[model samples]
Target: MGKAWLPFASYNLWSQFAPPVGQERWYCDMKRGYAKVRKREPEVTAILAEDTQPQRVGLLAQRGVYEFHADAQRLANDDGLAQVSQILRLEQESHGVKERLNQILSKYCENPILLGKRIFSLSRGDEGVPEPIRIRCGNYAFHLFAAIDCIFLEPDGTLHILDFKTGRSDFDERQAFVYLLAASYLYPQRRAIASFYNLELCKWSEPITATASQLNAVRIELMRLAQRHEWEKKQYRKNPVDFERIFPPNPGFQCKHCQFNRICQFSTREIS
Candidate 1:
């Protein structure tokens, strides 16, 4: 099988290179756990969906936002928000999700669509946009890929990449930067502004801009990460069955939220 393309590996420095000293077993457990679910295990997805309800609601709301604006008739439909809000109610979640969706619509409804595409765009173009833009670049080298939440092309030809966050979890600025970097590669001619919108807090992040120099730095880092990842894969291949000696685990606080914890052999007491 081909090696996996791990985008998060770029930001997670600790687990990227190797396991922490004397934690070989933990690394093996982590690797094994990931292997079992590499093909989208239904149980893992269901468990994760349950754990991240706010995120699910946020994604649904985002889709509603795109559909509402895409269809002129949707403007008059008072039930646009309510239709999406119904799922949250069925889940017995608080009214916060419904309120947050309204807040996001109110904030973005005024903007015109220069380029209309779904949440993620795999290919980039100024015209004839497609839904679900899945960015799959650097295939020969590192295989960088990402599904963007949304991309807006302003009248001035500037690109706005907005990622919606519904949960109260702290936003990782790196995620936005990674998307921005991908946008830079996909649309080099246009300048881009990337930000995070916290629907729960009804707050917008200060926009971050990316220039040619900044994008070049990102490219260099990605190349280095790709090389390192390949090296790790080679190490694993040396002893495929002996993951304990090849890919040791680094069990710690992060394990609590890890989807593979149930399958993890490592013992960690840090469960919040």
Candidate 2:
């Protein structure tokens, strides 16, 4: 996932890195030139988002999954490499397009692709970060992984937090609140900025507020899920949830836009 930014829907990239800065510029005094700038944005509308958490973006991205049975009907139903390759291409191009958007933002504003495939620094006191805490939640332990995008430190060291999003639509404050909870845990007492980047539209938001009330809700959810996960493991000694029960894909706009419609069981059943 080189140059991986809004480029695609892969979570690994989001968790570890971001899109390339197409253009970059000077921040603060413009004293020291920003070394990572690529393509530049002529105008700045909001705070710089640290990045997109893969789960949130993937949840709303273009996805199509097909599970083919190996029964007689499946004999002639094997997907050729072409279709699979097509899927690969879309993911690749989507990633590239996302990178382009990142480039534009970096050029226009002082936003930097701050975090990349680097170890989460946890050393404290001497300017180091500790290992990220991983807690199991509900029955969904390991449900999502998150990281801070950037801590825009003011001259006086005030902090503003921002998040990027690559969803085709549905960019709002809700998702930002999720990351804000994690960021708040990492950097307590510092007021933060949480916003979404609709890279498809090349537009970011202003006043994408981060609220304590919302962050509290996320914390509660995480805690509750962790407790549930503990109970399930002790009781079942394995995953207790059924795939069909937890992830029943109801026909809707997401299904309609799925790329694997032709071979999907749900699609065929709907047509029949």
Q: Whole-model Cα lDDT per candidate?
A: 0.55, 0.37
Query: TM-score for every candidate vs. truth?
Result: 0.62, 0.42
Off by over 4 Å in 1: 1-55, 73-76, 86-140, 241-247, 252-254, 267-272
In the range 36-82, model 2's lDDT, one tens digit per residue, is 11013221111112223443233222121110111223223344323
RMSD of 2: 20.4
Candidate maximizing lDDT: 1
Q: How do the residues 1-272 of candidate 1 rate in per-residue lDDT, one tens digit apiece?
A: 74554433343342334344454444444444344323265655555445344554666556655555555555556665455345334346456655655666554444423225333332221222222223343563444554566776666767888876665655666666767877766777778888877655666788887666776666566567656555655665675565555456677876765555675566364566
Stretches of model 2 off by over 4 angstroms after superposition = 1-131, 134-144, 208-213, 225-242, 259-264, 268-272
